[model samples]
Target: MSALAERWRAARPKVAGLHLDSGACSRPSFAVIDAVAQHMRHEAEVGGYVAAAAAAPALDAGKSAVAALTGMTADDVIYTTGSNHSLDLLLSSWTGPRTVACVPGEYGPNLALMAANGFDVRALPADGSGRLLVDATAAMLAADPPAIVHLTALASHRGIAQPARELAETCRGLDVPLVIDAAQALGHLDCAVGADAVYSSSRKWLAGPRGVGMLAIRPALAQRLRPRLPPADWNLPMTVLQRLEHGETSLAAQVGLSVALGEYLAAGAETMRAALAAVGKLTREALADVDGWRVVEPVGEPTAITTLAPTNGADPQRVRDWLVAERGIVTTHAEVQRAPFELAAPVLRLTPHVDTSAEDLATFRDALADATEEV
Candidate 1:
C-alpha cells in the first residue's frame, strides 16, 4: 500500500464506524486523543496554572501549526472555542460602523451574527452558479466599499469552492479588509488564499478535539483591531492575538489540536487532499447508478464533499438514520438552515476522508442503493 494509505489504515482502528462525516466532525487519531488525556493528567497533578506554564511550548506549537496551514505567523493565530466564537470575537472587536459584503450562500450563523451586530449585510452579485462576479464585486467596492468583504472558502452544504482568492485580490486592490471563514476548507483544501484573516474549527477537517479553533489575521490588520473588552490582566500581552483570547480555555484540547495538526502536516497536505478528493470522487461515481439519487455540484470544481439527495421524496434525515442503523455507515444530513440561500431541501452530505477505502465506499453505495429501494 502507499505510505499515505498505510498511515490511513493505521489510523482506522481509532474510529469505531465507517466514518464519512469529515465535513462535520472527523475522527481524531489515537495520538491526538492520548495527547489530550496526558495534558489533563498533568493539569490534575501540577495545578492548572503550573501545568499551563509547563505546556507553553506545546501550546505555542499549536498556533504554529495553524500558521503553517494558513501562511500566517504564529503570533497572528488566536485560539477560540470554535469558528463561531472566533467570528464573534472578530466582529465584536470591530470599532467602526459595520458593513459587510458576502455571497448569497453565506453561513447561516454568520448572517445572524452580522444582523445582531447591526452591520449592514450586502450580498455580492454572483453568476447563476453562485460564484461572486469579480467585476461586479469590484464595482460595488469602488462605489461603496463595505467595512469588510467576507467569504466562506467553501460551503458546508454544497460542493462548490468559492472564488476566495480572486475576491481577496479584489478586496486588496480596494484596500478593504477580507475575512475568510474557512470552517470547511482549512484542513480539507488549500487555504492559503492570502486573505486578511482566516478562521476555522479543529473538529472538522483537522480532526482535532472539539471546543478549540484558531484564527489568523495579518499583522497589519491585527494592529488595527481594538479589544472587545478591557484587559483583565495588565501584565498579560496585549497584542491583537492576545486581545481575542480571553478567559480560561481547555488546555488539553489545545494540546490535542496541536498534535492533530502535526499528524495532518506529517502526512503532507497535498497527499492528504488528493487522497480525500479521490475518495470523494469515488463516492460520487459509485452512487451515480443508484436510482433516485442525484450528486449535487455547482459550476466550480468540487472539493471532497459530495452532496447527494433522493429525488423520490425520501426524507434526508431518515436516509441518514437508515444508513447508520442498518448499514453501519455514518453520514451527515445537510439542512436548509445551514445554507439558507443555497439549499431548498436537505441533502445527504457524504464526506470521504483520507482513511476511506474503495471497499468501504462500494459498500456505502450498495447499502445506500438498497436503502433507497426500501425507504
Candidate 2:
C-alpha cells in the first residue's frame, strides 16, 4: 500500500472485508467517529443548546471547509440533512418559473423532487455516452434559458464524470443559475466547478458520519431565493444562505463532518483524486477479463465508480448477495430506478476508495468468477 492508502486504512479500523461500496457510504475514519462520540458526550453533559454554542467555532470551520471545497464564501454555506434535503430546499425556495434544464440521466429522486415542486424539467444536450456537449448546451441556454440548470457532477448509476465546469461556464456566460448535486463527487472529484450552488452529503466520499450535508449558494443567487416559511428574528443575523438552516440538527454529526473535511484537506485533494482515478481504471481493466460480466463505463473514464452488467441473464442482486454472504465483499446493486432514463436493467456497482489494494481487486475477481458459476 502507498503511504496515503496506509493512512486511510489505519483511520478506518472497522472496515472489515473488501469494502467496494464507497458510492453508498464510506468507512468513517476513527477521528470522525471520535468527534461524533465526544460531541454527543458533551451534549449529554451540557444542554443541547449549550453544547451547540460551545461547538460554534468548529462548526464555523466546517462551513469554511465546505466553502473552500465548493468555490464559495464561508457565509454562503448551510447545513442540511443530505443531498435530497438540500435540493428540495433549493427547488422549493425558487421565486421564478418552475423550469429546470438537467441531463437526461439526472438522479431519479431529483426528477421526482422537481415534479413535486412543479418544475418542468427538460433535458440538456448530451452526446451518446451521456456527457454534456458544451456548445450544444450553450446554444440551448441561449435559445431558451430555463429557470435554472442542474447537473450531477458524478452520477450514481455510472462512472462517467460530467462536464460540470464547462456547463458552469456556459451558465455563467448566459447568466443562468446552475445548481450541482455533488453527492458523489465532493471528495472523490474536483468540486470547485464555479456553479451558482453546490450541495452534497457527508457519507459518500467525505467519509463523514451520515445524516449531514451542505449547500453553498452564490451570494447574488442566495438573495433571490424566497422560501415560503417566515424567517425567524434569530436567523436575521445569519447570511441569506444560512437562513435556510433550521434550528434542530445533529451537532455531533456536524463535528464529525468537520473532522472528515479536515482529513481530506490533509490528504491533499489532487492526490486523492489521482489515486481514485487510477484505482477506477485498474478496476475496469481487471474486471474486463472476468467472464459472464461486462464493464459498463469506458476504461478511460476518470471516476472511482465501476458498474458491471451480468451476461447470460444472471441477476446482479443475487450476485451481490452471494458476494456478501460467501466472500465478505461489499458492492451496490444499481437498478433502473437509480437512473430511470438511462438504464435498462440492474448492474453491480463497485466503488473502491484509496484504501483498495491490488490484492483486494484480485480477490474480488476470483470471488466474482465463483459467484457467476454458482449464482
Candidate 3:
C-alpha cells in the first residue's frame, strides 16, 4: 500500500470509539490521555493530593515541555484551565485608556476585554471570504498604533489562521505588543513564537485533558504582565506561573499533557503536518464534488482542519446534524464571510491527525455523500 493508504488503514479501527460532537479527532499519538488515565488510577490507589504532590516534578517538567512545544521559554509558560481562561488572564493584565485594533471577526472575549478595559476598540474590514487581510491589519496598526494589536493564529469558529508574519511585521515598528490567540494553532500549525503572548487550550490538538491550558509569555514582556495573584514573585518557573494558572490544576492531567506534548514534538511537526495534510486533503477532495457543500483548502498553508458548508437547499446546521446523526462523520462548517473563518459559521471541522487512516477518510466520505442527500 502507498504511504497515505497505509495510514488510513491504520486509523480506521479507532474511529469507532469516538463520541464527541466536534469531529475534532486528532491523531492517536497524543497519548497523554492514557497517561492521565494511569495517573488517575494511581491517585485512586493513593490519595488525590498526595498523588499530585508525588507527580509534582513531572508536572513541573510538563511546563517546560509546553515551552519547548510552543517555542516560548520555560519560565513564560503558565498552566491555566484552558485557552479562554489564559486569554482572560492576559487581557486582565492589560489596562488603561488604550485603543485596541483588530481585523473584523476577532474572537468575542478579546473584544469584550477591550470594551471592559476601557480601551477604544476598532476593527478593519476583512476580505470577501471573511479572512483578516494581513496587510489591512498591518495598515490599521500603522495608522492607529493601539496599545495592543491582536490576531488569532486560527479563529475558533472558522479555522482560519491569520497571516502571522503580516500581522507581526506590521506591529514590528510600533511600541504596542502583538498577542496571538494560538488555541487553534498550537497542535495544527507551526507556531512562529514571535507574539508577545500566545495562549493554547490543551484539548484541541495537544490531546491533553480539557481542563488544562497553556500561556506562552515572551520573557521580555514578563515584567509587563500585572500578575493576578498578589505579591507573588514570578522569577521562578513555578512562581512566574502564578500570574495565570488559576483553579485547582490536575497533577496527572498536567503530566499527561506533558507526556502528550513530548510525544507530539518527537513525531516532529513536519511528520504530524504531513499526516494531517493527507487527511485534510482527502476531506477536501471527498466533499468537493458533493452538492451544497463548500470545502475550503486554506492558502495560509492550511492545517488538518477541513471545513464544509452546504451549497444549496441546506443550512450548515442541517448538514452538520445529518452527518452526525446518520453518518457518524464529524466536521466543522464556516460561512465565507467571517474573519478568521473558524468563528463565523458553525463549521464541520474534520481534523485528521497522524492517527487517522485513509480508510477512515473513505468512511467519512461515504457518510458525507449519503448525508448530502438531505433525507
Per-residue lDDT tens digits for candidate 2, residues 156-247, read: 99998998998998899999999999999999888898999999999998899999999999988988897655554445565556568866
Question: How much does candidate 3 score in TM-score?
Answer: 0.83
For each candidate in turn, give its C-alpha RMSD to the true structure in angstroms: 2.1, 1.6, 3.9
Pairs that clash in candidate 1: none
> Per-model C-alpha lDDT, please?
0.83, 0.91, 0.65
lDDT of 1 by residue, 1-375 (tens): 467766866874555657889888888888888999999999899898898898889889889988988888898887888999888888887877699999998889998898877889988987775677889989988999999889988888887778888888898898999999999988877888789999999999888999999889998787777775665355555666766785577989988999989888888888787776776677777776677878876313547788887788877888899988997789999999887986688989988777777788778878887777777
Report clashes for each candidate as comma-separated counts: 0, 0, 20
Q: Estimate each model's TM-score.
A: 0.94, 0.97, 0.83
lDDT of 1 at 280: 69
Candidate 2 residue runs with Cα over 4 Å from true position: 231-239
Clashing residue pairs for model 2: none
Candidate 1 residue runs with Cα over 4 Å from true position:
12-14, 231-237, 298-302
Give the backbone clash total of model 3.
20
Which candidate model has the greater TM-score, 1 or 2? 2
Identify the runs in model 3 with alpha carbons over 4 angstroms from their true place.
1-13, 17-31, 96-98, 109-119, 231-240, 298-301, 333-347
What tens digits encode model 3's per-residue C-alpha lDDT throughout 1-375?
Answer: 355435433533355533222224343332565778888998999988888788877777777877766677777787887766776776777644466667677777666666676678677557855567766666666776777777777765555556776666667667578778777777677776567778887767766666777888886566666665655454445444564566577766677778767766665766665665555565566667766667755533366666665556566666667876776665554444333323444555566554555566667766766776755
Lowest lDDT 10-residue stretch of candidate 2: 228-237
